[model samples]
Target chain A: MDYTDYYKLTCSEIQKLYRENKASPEQVVDSYLKRIEAVDGKLNAFVKLNRESIDKQLKDLKEKKEKPLYGIPVVIKDNICVRDEETTCASAILKGFKPPYDAAVIERLREAGAILLGKANMDEFAFGSSCETSCYGPTKNPWDLDRIPGGSSGGSAAAVSADEACLGLGSDTGGSIRQPAALCGVVGLKPTYGRVSRYGLIAFASSLDQIGPITKDVRDAALLLNVIGGHDPRDSTSVNAPKPDYTKSLINDIKGLKVAVPKEYFVGGIDKEVSLYIGEAIKTLGSLGAKIGEVSLPHTDYAVSAYYIIAPAEASSNLARFDGVQYGLRSKAAKDSLLEMYNRTRAEGFGSEAKRRVILGTYVLSSGYYDAYYLKALKVRTKIKEDLEAVFKEYDCIVTPTSPTPAFKIGEKKEDPLSMYLSDIFTIPVNLAGIPAISVPCGFTKNGLPVGLQILGKPFDEETLFKAAYAYEQNTEWHKRRPSL
Target chain B: MVSKDNNNKKSEIDVGYVAKLARLALTADEIKRLGKQLNDILGYIGKLNNVDTAKVQPTSHVLPLKNVERTDKVVPSLRIEETLKNAPLKENSFFKVPKVIE
Candidate 1:
């Protein structure tokens, strides 16, 4: 296999190569380093590359016998804690905050012999839909430098798409991972909430958060999911359940499966190209002997509204810890009063988006308006979850265009927060309902940007979702096309 | 548009009250800005009133979790110095802050 292809090979292929001695751990690591050196400047995908430490780990792994992920290199979002590396979360406030301990997921990845490549840039506190909020600046799309890679996982997706890293770990809240993956033309999965441990992910909205894999193909996503998805005693919210064999079901045929296409998803404002490509994929599934039907998630229109309230409300609480007291950056000067110091520290530390949300969240959750806003949104959220549960009972899977449109220019929606929130309209409800959803590249737009078809499955049924997505991928040539990086 | 009655204090939630409850000491200009922004956002959210939610019970959490009881065992924590290393000001294993009650 070509050494460049070593960086793009499927997880299973890499494992086979390592087992058969056709490739060694050091060679695989070396291949990715050279690729990063050669191409990363143009892509701007990585915020930090720990070449020396990762090489040391690879040398140690090579000395030992074969292990799971023995030679595989994986990149992590900058927000997720990896000991000794700066976990900036792409914010100036956290510029030099090196974590002293590994996040729960990082420990697992390290134990599995996976090489920690580096930290990928993200939206500050994983807040923005586009990666433009980063203190380092926006991560440009590898396919077209002028366009943006969908964010807050944009760097993670861009790195994988540009072949700078084999696979990347990203946190998804309100479609952060899947939307960017769709926009960047890669596979991104938001595992069922609580399916993966959230002990180390810097909080965006604690309730909606999940750590998942972004990769080039479905099976690698499944394999990474298998490695990362499991309960941790440290995380109180983790689900105590056995992990299913995610890779075993990827090859299963989708004949006679019931797929639901919600009518509300096909409404106005969805780009014509996205709708057309997703419609073609649906028709292709129908031709392959699967039963397709129209279903209504009537409460979906309220999803974006409900998401903003709950996510920010939870965010305001989760972020209160960074009060210039316990961790992260602190203000420099002393003040006469504690309150004045608090305000000054916060005003200087947090970015614009973070401050705006904190103010809104605090207002909504305050004494008088708690029942009017936060409580009411939570009630609406219940109905939204119920709506999906009702539909899932009748259909095995739900399909929709992953994003309303293709990757937009970097600064297009930055000024208008409402418009930016609408970008994740289709993907937010899945996170709200805590279901497994994956974004797979379906087709390219007229401008040559990738459009994705989102496939959502019942809770913990990632196996079935992967089978259908893999089947759809097999019928089309979209996954074979690579960005001319 | 709904008319404001002399006794319509319930419908007219003042920004000052909201700010005070939120512990935000806003200036006149800040309050005006927040007032307009909140009104616009609240108007958009007001659309939810059109739905027939009278019969529905309020739902707080999506997952049907109950008794998420942990073992209550103490796990090892990061070294106090390491954890507090990022603090802006610290002394004697505690985060240093100005006196609150003096």
Candidate 2:
């Protein structure tokens, strides 16, 4: 088989090739490296390519016994640490910072025989909805080079969509993974919060952030999640629950499954084309014997507002550790006074969006305002969670459009922060509710940009989400369509 | 309590104060621009006020587990040299910082 054909193979297919001795892990890594070198210049998908580490992993594979994900190449979001590799979180503040230890997910991937391909770019500190805020310039959508790939996990999504790597791991805090996966035309899943360990994921929102897989198709998402989604002692919030073999949920049968289409999600401001695709997807699911009904999640209007408050408030506290004394970029201009040094180091290191969120977070959590803002947001968050739980009582899964629209032009929403925040409106509620959600390509717009159908399930019931998503995916040709780069 | 109408005025001063608390130095232009952006975002989030959460408990975490403590055992951890390797300025296994309490 040609090396070019290797780039097009899914994780399962690659494993099959390895079993047959048709391709070596070295050749697969070389093919992807060459593809990244050829196409990443245009897509800007990868922030730092770990060439030496990848070569070392390839050599190490010769001594390892057969394992799941054997010989498959995987890309990790820049925020997730890999020992001795630069995990910048796509921020200038964390530039040149190499972690001394590997993230829990990285350890799992290595144990499963997956080679680390590279670190993909992202919104600095995962603060923005679009990839445009990266210290490394924005990653372009593979389908339409001029459009922005939906983000903070945009680079990971773009890399998987462009086949720069077989599978990409992305941390979704308020739709970072799913939104970009929607825009980039790939499968992105956010496991139930705490389902996957957050040991080395650079904190964006500790309660909300989840590391999941971005892949060319749903089965690959399941395969990658099977390896990475489990309990870890390092993350205190890691759920001490039995980890199931996610691959078993890939059965393409959704007969008699109850699916809910939330009326609030489709009400207004959604692009006509996106709504049309979602409508078609719903009908297709119904055709497959899944009973679909309209349900109302009344507090959906408050989800975005609540998410912004909670995520940033957590971010403010989490990001405090980035003070120059410990690690990362430090400002040389404030050598006069310690206070001046602390101030200058942070201001110079962080980007505009990071600064904005920190200020907002600090203000909301400040004295006298805590009740009206931070505390109130938390209360509203409970209401949103209740809303989803009520629907899930009768429905196995809730489906919605992953994003309001298809990929917009790169600079379209950069100037308007509120508009940019709206990009994650559909995906944010799942995070605020801390439920499992997966975004799968449903259809394309007239301009050929992909539209995502989001399937959300009860917490720790990712098996149900995989079942629903896999059924719909098998019935459609959307997942097979690749972006012509 | 900052009123909704006075929120914009409060934001002007609040942005500066919050930046100070965050230990982030902001130039006059950045402060001015960020003040407006923060105000805009805060105003949008003001929609959360509509919900009546008098009976609802604040959810710090969705999971049922509490106080996930491990056994107090000494384990092999990162070496001191490895821990300080990423520090921008270091002095013999210690992170170097600007002089304080001078």
Find the 10 residues in a row with the least total lDDT in model 1 chain A: A62-71
Native contacts kept (model 2): 0.85
Give the DockQ (2 decimals) of all models: 0.40, 0.71
Across residues A229-314, which tens digit of lDDT does each residue of candidate 1 receive?
A: 89997787889988988878887489999999999999999999999999999999898878999999999898988888888889
List of chain A TM-scores, every candidate: 0.97, 0.99
Comparing chain B with the reference, what is the TM-score for each candidate? 0.74, 0.84
Candidate 1 second chain TM:
0.74
Q: Once superposed on the true structure, which residue ranges of model 2 sit more than 4 Å away at CA?
A: B1-13
Which candidate wins on DockQ? 2
Predict model 2's lDDT versus the native. Answer: 0.90
The CAPRI category of model 1 is: acceptable
Give the per-residue lDDT digits (tens) of candidate 2, residues A217-317: 99999999899988899999999899999999989899999999999998889999999999999999999999999999999999989998899899999
lDDT of 1 by residue, B1-102 (tens): 011221323243366665443444456765676566655555566555555665677766656777778777888888888988777778999988877886
Q: How many residue pairs clash in each candidate?
A: 0, 0
